[model samples]
Target: MSTMQPILRSLPRLPAPNLWQSKFKGSRARGHLRVSVMTEDAADAAVKDMQISDHPQRSIIEIFPGPGQLTRSMVMAGAKKVITVESGETFQESLKALEQNSEGRIQHFAMNPLSDPFDEILLPEHTAIPGLKPQSWDKVHEDVMIVGSIPNSATGERVLHELLTASIQRMGVFRMGRVEMYMFCYKDAVQRLIAAPGMPPRNRVTLLAEAAAEITPLVRPGAAHFHLPYDYQLLRLVPHEKPKIETSVDVMDFCLRSLFTNKSHALNKVIKYERAHAIGSEFLGHPLLGPGAEILLGRLSFDHNIKVKHMTLDQLNEVALKFEQWPLRPTVLYDDMIMYESRRKR
Candidate 1:
């Protein structure tokens, strides 16, 4: 029986080809974006790496689980329950079969985790697994975990950015408390997600992600699978019990976008240039200048020539909070109208 275990664990052939290819073409085309763990060994390794058996009470929310390979591994590894949110229909038959065999342990939701609002999809009644309860904003929810493989494409990047933003705002899944995320991301995206201040890859996403969660790289990129064009690294993003940045998500977004326009430029110079209608002039009255700027720099104990890229996460948080509290700050920042319309629709 011990010897036969290896053979029993072998994986089936890869999923259909069209399922892996992006639907869009030309400039918008991202070739073979959907990467899946093709072998049972890889699937089991991922489940083990994520420590599925450690928390038997925690339910998993899996995104883009192609052919339900890792999904089965999670269940076999002792996951109490798995709620699969798969956007594509190509794997529905396989997922439905898994659900039928799981004796209510697995549930499938045909929704796009990226675009669909959690409030609309992951309703309390629908995800009513034992031990999973709403937790305070400053507490980590140990009962639920999110797992998935992110595609290597613009769509994937945009979704990750939105998720980080939602986390910072304590909206969506994050509203249930500091829900933890274990995701397989392309190597470059993982680099940017975990990049620190002064790192070349540090950008708005880096700042937002750092402000929202404690991101750890659990697995380094390995040899690419036959169906994948790039190697994917596994990341564990645990939302901070209390977010590092206390300002509104809009304010933080605005500040990061403004500062990172010329990330290498001196902080004072950037503010002065911005105020002078030389950079980000549309947001001229932003609090990144005048007394607000002076106070932020004073808090950081940094000289006027300090580059924006060199500021730490706390320093960046200070900038955003100061901007938020500025008495004379503009009533609206860029995209305020767009956001307002979006909220109205919802």
Candidate 2:
């Protein structure tokens, strides 16, 4: 429904860039990289759905915008400023063309988003999210958007995790505000983001994502969507207005890692096999869970035989709250790799 949508649809398709034309000459040869081109209509629809046009002063930090396909749509849709973080030089010509056309409205960063400190290179001075300040965790702002199609790998997942954690912690790429991320990732990555308590493939990421943000499916791949070898989805993640648990992220992180060792096993059954030796060490060092796993388990007030997959979000929050009240804090170093070995044995 945007004015740009019609204009973009009528423009003639340009020839694929040299990197994509040759396909085998550059990063395409690296095998890990993939560039999924979509029609201008598709890009326009995606930008419109994100509501970027609603904000006249919107700023976007896009990751891995190979050759600026979506970037063009964003600029056309009226984003106030656009900054793309891309490392590969293969798309330099096309992106430079976009920059030249924007007349200073668009900028490009020739750096890896995963390794670079965003404040140092990615975000320009005026682009910082309003009302953001150092060491201010509770401060809230809503002017910035992070949009990208991340690579489908552990490294890509790690980068997203780091970005979300930094946002929650009010550091790194998140200094501008609690960012809203719209990411296109493989179906498996999507599963990890939306995984529930007792679902298959549930693990650390499930709790980490749930505790930090509300993940919603924006688009599901279908015949009309962008073509790719594997099905993928666009997910929207916004920080939770009120997190289910009000404990240290580290505490909940340690607790979830310790308890989900045998995720399918009943909570009572797995607790016995967890590294009790590490309970006094630094590994299971959560303030509440570190000292009193049994106590928190009792507070759950559920059948000890319940599998973690079956537990609801409220039940998980109950566990966290119970840990906060424990008077005697203990330290632990439970072997975090218990679940990995369990999966291998299965």
Candidate 3:
């Protein structure tokens, strides 16, 4: 896995294609442009900033390594093993060249990284891929790193959401270790990650990312590292060493989504609407509701109009802790508790 030259220097020069030039149906469409690192220097600098050199044993899983600029950089950086999932066959020749040069150190799969589940790709048993090790659910390893850039589109959002969901659920590749993500995404997405309590645009994604992991910004928007017109961001995400709140991923998702439906609604109104109904009543009775659960029933005189967006991470964690105390878990049901309130008012 060691390379004498810097990773980029080791890579043979390849044509960097623009989105319009791509033959992939999805890529040729408007507003689905892929932002690629056009130069080896940029790629090398990005990897260097990640500081992966100290961990020579660390492996990488790259998504959509279009044109192989960063792919070459990672390989040159001496990644123990590089596994890539690329759906489009357009870059086959260059990617194949990389695979051959790496001497089996790089494994390329011609599958859509978004549609394919990580379990089948990362686990040996789940996948028939030989020579791979089986990862256990209870075990943890931090050697695996996920690195790549996603397109700036709705599809890209879904792809990122899927990756985060996998991490939160600790399934597949995530189960193999404490997976780390080094990603290039829209600046707005980065804002969502680091948004503080009472910040504008705070919503479900913000809560889920903060609850599941610690997000750190590697590069801010408008950085000189990128050659694109729109601002892009580089970020790193790793699960919390010791989670502040112990709860299932489902509860977090259901509770947060239900509460944040109307982000501007006061917390008191939100809670009352949710708990006053049949479903809320049943949820309150659950053992996880805990002895002190009744305390939440009384609305605080201060901040009676406090919205979900106004709550800090600590406050959100506190809410999660209280809800987890409930004994019986309720299935997530989508209902307009607000509409019910409106009907009652009428």
Predictions: Cα RMSD each: 6.3, 6.3, 6.8
- Listed in order, each prediction's TM-score against the native is 0.79, 0.75, 0.74
- Per-residue lDDT tens digits for candidate 3, residues 111-137, read 777775466676555332334443443
> Quick one: how many clashes does candidate 1 have?
0
Clashes of 2: 7
Off by over 4 Å in 1: 1-28, 124-131, 136-139, 274-300, 336-346
What's the distance in Å from true for residue 235, model 2?
1.8
lDDT of 1 by residue, 1-346 (tens): 1111111132233354444445211132563477665556667778888998787777888887866778888887777788888866666777888887776778888787777456765665775354355787566677787888887787788878888877877777776778888888888998888887788888888888887788888765364441354677788988887678778888888878777766887777666544323434243433333434554555444465778888888777777787778776667677543443354358
**Model 2 weakest lDDT span, ten residues long:** 1-10
Which model, 1 or 3, shows the larger TM-score? 1
**Residue 110 in model 3: lDDT:** 75
In model 3, what is the error at residue 169, expressed in angstroms? 3.1
**lDDT (0-100) at residue 134 of candidate 3?**
38
